[model samples]
Each structure stands twice: as C-alpha cells, then as structure tokens.
Target: MAQAAREPDFRTRLQEWIPKLVLSPSVAAMVVFVYGFIAFTVYLSFSDSRMLPSYDLVGFGNYAKLWGLSAWWTAIVNLGIFASLYIVTCTAIGLVLAIFLDQKIRGEGMLRPIYLYPMALSFIVTGTAWKWIMDPGIGIENSMHLWGWTSFEFDWIKDRNMAIYTVVIAAVWQTSGFVMAMFLAGLRGIDNEILKAAQIDGASSWSLYRRIVIPLLRPAFLSAFVILAHLAVKSYDLIVALTGGGPGRATELPATFMYSYTFTRNSMGIGAASAVIMLMTIAAIMTPYLYAELKEKT
Candidate 1:
C-alpha cells in the first residue's frame, strides 16, 4: 500500500510539471528574443548609435532631433489622421454589422464568412490589390473611361491631399470585419433575459439599443478602440505595399519613418527613439484596458 501511494504521488507530480516543461522553451525564447531586443533597442535609443549600434551615450539628443525633423512631424500628423479615421470608421462599421447579424437574419452563416473573408488575406495582399484598383491608368478611372464615362475621375492615390484617406479606406476594408467579430461575440455573451425585460417594458428597438444594449457593450467598444489604435500606430506593411509613404510623404506613418530613418538614412539612434515612442503609445492604450480586466477578475 505504501509503495502504491508513493507511485501515484510521483505520477501526479509528473502530470503537474508536464505542461510547464512543455511551455518553458517558448517562455525562454520570448524572454531572449522579444524582451531582450526591446531592452537593447531602448538602450540604443539613448546611445549615439547610427548605421550600427554604438555604445556612446547621447541621452535625449536623438529624441530632440527627432522632434525637430519636418519628416517626423509629417509622419505624426498623418498617423493622427489615419488612426482617428481608421478607428472611428472601423468601429462604426463593425458595430453596425454585428448588430445586423445579431438579429439572426437569413443566410447568417453565409454572410459572416463573406464579411470576414477580407481579414483572412494578409495586409500586404490587401494593399497590393487596392493599389491596382486605385491606379488611375489601369484602375477605376481607366475602366470608366473605356466604358465611355470619359469625365470619370478617381485619382486619390496619386493626389497628395487625398492619399492618406485612401489608406484609411483600405484599412477599414480589411479590419472592420474583425471588429465586427469582437462586437458579435460581446453581443452573444449578453444575457437574453435583460433584452427581453427591456422589450416588455415598452422599449422601442432604437431606445433599447441606445440605453441598454450599447451600454452593455462598453467592454467590446473599449477592446475595439485599443486594438484599432495599436494597429494604426504600428501600421507599416499596408502603407508600404499601398502608397510607399509617397505623394511626397503624405502617408508617412511612424513605422515607415522609423524604418526609413534607421536603415536607409543611417540614423539608428533617432529610429530607435521613434520606435520607443511608438511602443509607449501602444503601452498607454493597452495598460488601462489590462488593468481594468485584471481588476474585474479580482
């Protein structure tokens, strides 16, 4: 009996450790690759590194110079416009789609996948496709002209004044569906009893949503905002494949600026500084949501 009890205890301990042992390698890689690089980048931001890593400390010199640059300012302004429109448009479209789907309309199963199909494609692919569709000579304008609509004009992609909005349109096309999924999940999780009670209390559909349904979806709203804001701040590939930060830097977001400065311009220190600022922006958006989530759990 003593031997059997000892055997079972050993087996139980082995079971408990198996998962941890399996996860250790991933945790170790994350520590070394993810966090280690982050720390190194932060250090480089403070140093006089340019073209390559340098150990000479320059303090906030890189940051000061970065703030003074006209290109950096242009990137900042473009990001503000892109992020604002991206977030608002995505949220509005996603919320509306979610609400529509929640009503259990016919072909619900078919429609959900159709709505989400764009998101399955990588941003690079989406950007490239949109680039073709928006090109003046071969895209919408050309096609319209060939069809005898000679006066048709849709050349926003080449226009400096309207290029950033084109980015917004592409981004919204790709991400709004994902936001829809988030809101849909939130809607599904809501208790049906509450909705029923509101209906019995003589609440109209609009009033019901405005007062109760929308209020309860606060968590979804916050989540969508945080996600969209983070994406907007770090957007690179989509802009690269679509606009290449062109029309004379009309869509030069911080990500593109960081890459161009660090690698091409040989200003690693300033690039690192910009990267740190971007990281901080993401952290600022994430920290509050994480705290609220943890607080609710506790």
Candidate 2:
C-alpha cells in the first residue's frame, strides 16, 4: 500500500512540473534575446561605438549630442503631431462606431466585419495602398481628371507641408477599427439594468451617456489611450511604407531617426541613445498602467 501511494505521488509531481519544463526553453530564450539584447543596447548608448558596437564607455555624451541634433528635434516634433492626431481621431471614430453598433442595428455581424477588415491587413499593405491612392499621377487625382473633374486636386501626399497629415490619415484608418472593437466589447459588458434605470429617471440619451455610460467606460478609455500611445511612440513600418520619411524630414519620426543615425550614418552611439529614449518613453507610458493593474488585482 505504501508503494502504491508513493507511485501516485510521484506521478502527480511529474505532472505538475511538465508544463514548467515545456515552458523553460521559451522563457530562457526571451531572457537572452529580449532582455539581454535590451541591456546590451543600453550599454551601447553610453559607449563610443560608431559603425559597430564598441565597449569604450563615454557616459552621457552621446545623449547630449543626440539632443543637440536638429534632425532629432524634427523627429520629436513630428511624433508629437502624429501621436496626438492619431490618438484623438482613432478614439473619437472608435467611440462613435461603438455607440452606433450598440443600438442592435440590422445586419450587425456583416457591418462589424466590414468596419474591421482594414485592421486585418498589414500596415505595409495599408500604407502602400494609400500611397497609390494619394499619388497625383495615377491615383485619385488622375481618376478625377479622367472623369472630367479637372478641378479635383488631392495631391497632399507630395506636398511637404501636408505630408505628415497623410501619415496620420493612414495610421488612423488601420487602427480605428481595433479601437472600435475594444470599445464595443466594453459597451456590451455594461449592465442593461443600469441603462434602463437611467432611462426611467427621465434621462435623455445624450445625458445618459454623458453622465453614466461614458464614465463607466473609463477602463476602456484608459486601455485605449495606453495602447494607442504605445503604438504611436513605436510607429515605424507604417511611416516607412507610407512616406519613407517624406519629401524631406517632414514625417521623420524618432524610430526612423534612430535607424538612420545608427545604421546608415554610422552614428551607432547616437542611434543607441535614441533607441534608449524610445524605450524609456514606452516604459513611462506602460509603468503606470501596470502598477494600477497589479494594485487592483492585489
């Protein structure tokens, strides 16, 4: 009997450890590739490396020079515009779509997919498609002219002063559907009793949303902001695909700036510094949300 009990105990212990053993390799890889590389990049930011990695430490000098560069400042300002407009437009459009869909409208399933289809495509595809559509020679402008609307001019993609807004437009189109889904889920989760209670209290539709429903959706709002802000900061591929940092430095964001300096310009130290700044920016946005989530769980 003692032998039988020992056999079952051993089996149970083995079962408990099997999942951990399976996961150990992935965890180790993440530590080495993700976190290990991050540490190395941070170290490089402080070194005198150029064109390649060097171990000679130079303190914060790289950071100082990085800030002094006009290109870096241009990227920062462009990011400000792009991030602000991208976040606001996506949120607004998403909220409106969510509210519209929550009314139990006909063909709901069909409409939801139609709205979300853009998100299914890769950013590269969206950017390339929009680029063709916005190009004056063979895109909308040409099509309009062919249709005899000679006065129809929509060549903003080639205009330096208006180029950054084109990036905003493409980014918003790709992301708004995702934000809408988040909000729709939030809306669906709201208690119908609460909405009915407000309705019975003589509250108008606008008043109900303004005073109660919107406030209750605070979690969704916070989540949307965090996700959008993170995306805005790290946005790279879309800009590269759409504008290629533009007719000039008009749409050059920090990510592009970092790549240009680090790899192309042989200013690896500056690039590393810029990369660290980007990492810090993401951390700053993420840290608060994480703390709040952990605190709430506890």
Best TM-score among the predictions, by candidate number = 2
The stretch of ten residues in a row with the least summed lDDT in candidate 2 is 114-123
On residues 212-275, what C-alpha lDDT tens digit does candidate 1 reach at each position? 9999999899999998999999899999999999989998999999999999999999999999
| Residue 152 lDDT in candidate 1 | 97
lDDT of 2 by residue, 177-239 (tens): 999999999999999999999899999999999999899999999999999999999999988
Taking every candidate in turn, the Cα RMSD to the unseen true structure, in Å, is 2.4, 1.9
Count steric clashes of candidate 1.
Answer: 0
lDDT scores of the candidates, listed in order: 0.96, 0.95
Worst 10 residues of 1 by lDDT: 114-123
In model 1, what is the error at residue 251, expressed in angstroms? Answer: 0.8
lDDT of 1: 0.96
Misplaced by over 4 Å in model 1 are 1-22
